[model samples]
Target: MEKWVVALLAMSAYLVFAFIVGVLAGRGRSFWSVSEYTVADRGLGLVLMWFLMGGTVFSAFAFLGGPGWAYSKGAASFYILAYTCLGLLPWYLIGPKVARIGARKNFYTMGEFLGDRYDSRAIQVLVGVISVLAFIQYLTLQIKGMAYVFNVLTEDAIPIWLGALISYGIVIVYVATSGVRGAAWSDVLQGILMLLVAWVVGYTVVYSFHDGVADMFRGIEASRPGFLTVGAEGSGMSPMSYTTILLVSVIGFIMWPHLFTKSFTTTEKKIKQTVLVYPLFAIFLVPILFIGFAAVGVVDPAQLTGPDTILPHLVTHEMGASGIVYGLIGAGALAAAMSSADAITHGGSVSFGRDIIQPLKPDLPERTQIWIMRLSVIAIGTVAYYLSIFGAAGLVQLLVGAYGSIVQFAPAVYGALWWRRGTSTGVIAGLVAGIAVNYYFQLVQPATPLDINAGILGLIVNVVLFVGMSMVTNPAGSRADEYIKA
Candidate 1:
């Protein structure tokens, strides 16, 4: 069979599997209820929670961007592993508390929790706007990843836009119908498949290039001297950049809306246990870096159009068009893209429907609100699909800015749970200042005022405003007293 034919078969089979899982998940359930659809009735177990969390975190970045970074930048690629492991560590302490509050308050979205905590509709609106924007940006990246895989693996037999539409259209239908439960179950299957493929491809590339793993490293050391060592000379990234990236990712990881909303889907114990086992997921990515290293001498970085396309190019060229292996790689890449997309699409809809719409229109019926949520999923999915097709150089900047700005939620989140003195004025002022600073640094001036990340700079300003404002402003009187009491 032709390689394109084999690739098409592989992707189609994976989509079929996902659709089946999604349909099955919706069966015999009370799909009409908002709680059931959004949070699976808060009844997810440890096993499902583990895979859901792992699968959500390991997106197209792990499969494609991880190795590409390793191949192109040397030791800097280890940032993938460092950030993944460290990012979830603090969640152990924070996850259960958020879960407890969510369960007690019947909160289904992060915006709900923040709004109720602050007793301010404006704060909720601000969070809702940012969540929707960030999630849409995130969805665009996932669509692009899927488009790239389909286009390249099929040798351009399928156009990029059509490929993205087909893949994500399935996600929209399933998520609108089945909700979070459908996303979790499909993630389990995808998570397992992608992990297996990462190991197989990583080892295969090393064995093909050199005698063994040790021999491959030996070759690297001889040619690129210190390439295997940390802080290697001639490495494209500085140690400060490496350390900052790791710190930012780790601290900012759980702040993501999709990850934050998952807290409402499971028990506190299950959430903690899932976090404990989540670090193992980081191990699956180490081999992907090996694939990039294997391509170091064989492939020229300049010849490659972009870092994200390197992995697909390697599999199609190096794997010799073997039907089954090519099929497996395609399946794995599809899993990576689809798993992340479902969660993002779902989270974006929930934020839009609950945080922005329902609050403004208190008279909206539950059934109508549910319909709005479903419609928002399709609308957001279509917008992202079109954006991905056009493509943008600013995507990287947009994502970094979003992540950095979103992490400003850290103070609000942590303050709500532990600190009694935190006030509404403090939280709102801090968030605005942080996001404004982050935006200015990212867009207005490409360089940070002092070589720090824009988000990091924003965070510093956020802290000052938060502490200073709280000292001067009074709380919301009876309303604030009642919320804190609750």
Candidate 2:
């Protein structure tokens, strides 16, 4: 058989296996139950929770963009590692509280949790709109990664749009049919597969191209001086930019609607355990960066299409026609992209059904809501697919841009949980102001004052408005006290 054919077959096998596993995961679960489809009945075990959380966070961005940053931006890539380490710390304190409250209130989405707390439907609708928009940006990156892998490994036999449609089409089927169970179970397989591939590929590429890991760095350091050091002269990123990005990530990490809703998937004890063990997953990313650094001098920058393609480009060209190597990289990259995409897709559907549709109609039947969520899987996937193909931003760039808006939810979330003075008008005003300021800085003006992350700047304005308005506005009465007590 030809090399590309053999490689394609290997990738095809993995996709088939993932489809079977994902579909079967929903076999015994209640398809019509809104609770079952959205949060696995809030009974997920520790192991499943670990992989679901890890796999969802470490998306194609980590597998592809991690190396891309190392290859293109040098040490600035370490921000990914830094943020991952600190991001979940706040979750430890907040996750249990949110889980307890969610369980009591029968909350399955962040919008529901906030809407009930602040006593405002407008806030729920705003959150729904923000979450779905951010999800599309996020899902776009994962689809791009999947399409890039199939197109490259298959030698472009599978066009970008078709490849995305095929892989994500399977994801949509299992997610729509099986719900969160499909996403969680499949993540178990994907999480294990991608970790094994990352280390093996990272080790092989380093030695294949250079004497060793140490020698690989030595060559780059000697040739490109300061590329390995952040904020150094010629490093491509300044210290303030790096610092602000890191800060925003830590604040915004768990605020992601998909991740926040995970608080309802399992118990409070398991939530803390997941957060504690989450840092080890960050270790898996170290080797992923090695793959990018290994390519520094070996591959010419001008020849490659984009920094994100460096990984697959090296695997196909330098691995000497070994179909196994091509297949391994293809499956692993797909795993990274698919794992995250499934969860985001599932979350987006739930958000649409629960936050946007239910609040507006208020009397929609439970069965009708489930069907809407199921159909939303296709609708949301279609929008994200269009963006993935047409969007010009880099993977990490897309992620950070999404984070700015998501981080805007921080004050409202924290206030709902702890503060008694929080009022509906205050939450609405803060959320709107924060989102507007964030957009203005992010899109309207790229050059921010003092080089702070646009998200952080918006957050500053958001806090002021939220607090100032709440003090003047009447408290939410006994309901606010009851919510905080819960």
Candidate 3:
């Protein structure tokens, strides 16, 4: 067989395997039960929870953007490693609390949890809207990654639109059918596959063009001084900027609706266990950064269209001679993209059904609710796919912009668990204020004062509003006390 054909077959084989596994995950489970579909009846074990959390957190960004950052920004890429290690530490505390409340309340979505705490349909709908918006943007980036992988590995034989549709279509099917279980099981496979591929590519590249890891860094330092040190002369970001971004992520990382909702999928002890072992996933990412650094002097920066293309470029130009290598790289990239996309798609559908639609039609039957959620999987996935293929030229910017607003949920979430004085009025007011301030700073005037992230500035305003408004308003009283005691 021809080289491209062989590569395509290898990638195709992986996709087929993923589809079978995802579809089978729902078997013998209660398809009609909302609890079964959304949280697998809250029975997930340690192994499944570990991979689900690990795979979802380490998305296509780990494969593509991680290398891209290292290739373009040098030590600025270390910020990813730093945040990944620290982001889930907060979860160790937050996750168990959330799981306790989630089990007591029978909550399956963040909107549901927040809405019940605040006793307001308005807050629920607002969270649903914000979550869906962020989900689309986040899913768009993953779809784009999947398409890029297929197109580049096949030498452009598969068009961007078709590649995205094919990869994400399978994701949609499994998500609609098997729901969270499908996503969790597939992630186990994907997490393992991508880790292996990352090591293979990272190690091969480091040794292919250089003597060794030490020699590679020595050569880079001698040629380009300070490139490996952030805030240094050649570094891409300032010290203040890096520090603030890291701080914001540590708070916002668990606040993501998809991740927050995971608390309901397993026991509190399992949730804590997952967070404990999560740092190992960060260690696996070290090799991905190696690939980008290996190409620093070898690949011509001027020849590439964007830094994100560095991984594919290296695979095509350097490893193209071996069909097996090309196929594995393609599969690895697709795994990274699909693993996250499945979770986002499942979360979006559940959010749409429980958070947005259910509140609007509170009288809807359970069967109708499940049907709506199933159909929502297709509806949300279709929209994300369209945006990925035809939306703005800068989709990554959209994800960054959405993140600023996601962090706005921190005050409301933390307040619900710890502060008896918190009220629905205060939570709603604070969320709106924080999102508005975040948008203004992030998109309106990105050159934030003091080189700090716009999200942090928004958070400052949010906390002030949250605390002040709560002080003046009536407390949630017994309801708030119940959650705190949980």
Among these predictions, the greatest lDDT belongs to 2
lDDT of 1 by residue, 1-486 (tens): 886788799889998988899768777888778898889999987777888788776787778787777787778788888887777887888777778778888999888988887777888888999999988888888888888888888889889888898889989988999888888888888888899999988898888877887887778778897676656686756666666666667777898978898888987788788878767888778898888888878787777788777788887876564766777788898899899899899999999998999889979888998899999999999888888888675334445666887888888877777666677899999999998987888789857643666777788898888878877887664334433444
Candidate 1's C-alpha runs over 4 A off are: 229-232, 394-398, 477-486
Candidates in order have lDDT scores of 0.82, 0.91, 0.89
Give residue 11's error in model 1 in angstroms.
1.3
* Predicted candidate 2 versus true structure: per-residue lDDT over 43-119, tens digit per residue: 99999899999887679999999899999989999988888888888888788888888998899999999988887
Candidate 2 residue 77 C-alpha distance from true site, Å: 0.5
Candidate 1 lDDT at 389 equals 85
TM per prediction: 0.96, 0.98, 0.98
Off by over 4 Å in 2: none
**What C-alpha lDDT does candidate 1 achieve relative to the native structure?**
0.82
lDDT, model 1, position 213: 76
By TM-score, how accurate is candidate 3? 0.98
- Clash pairs, candidate 2, are none
User: How many backbone collisions does model 3 have?
Assistant: 0
Q: Kindly give the stretch of ten consecutive residues in candidate 2 with the minimal lDDT sum.
A: 477-486
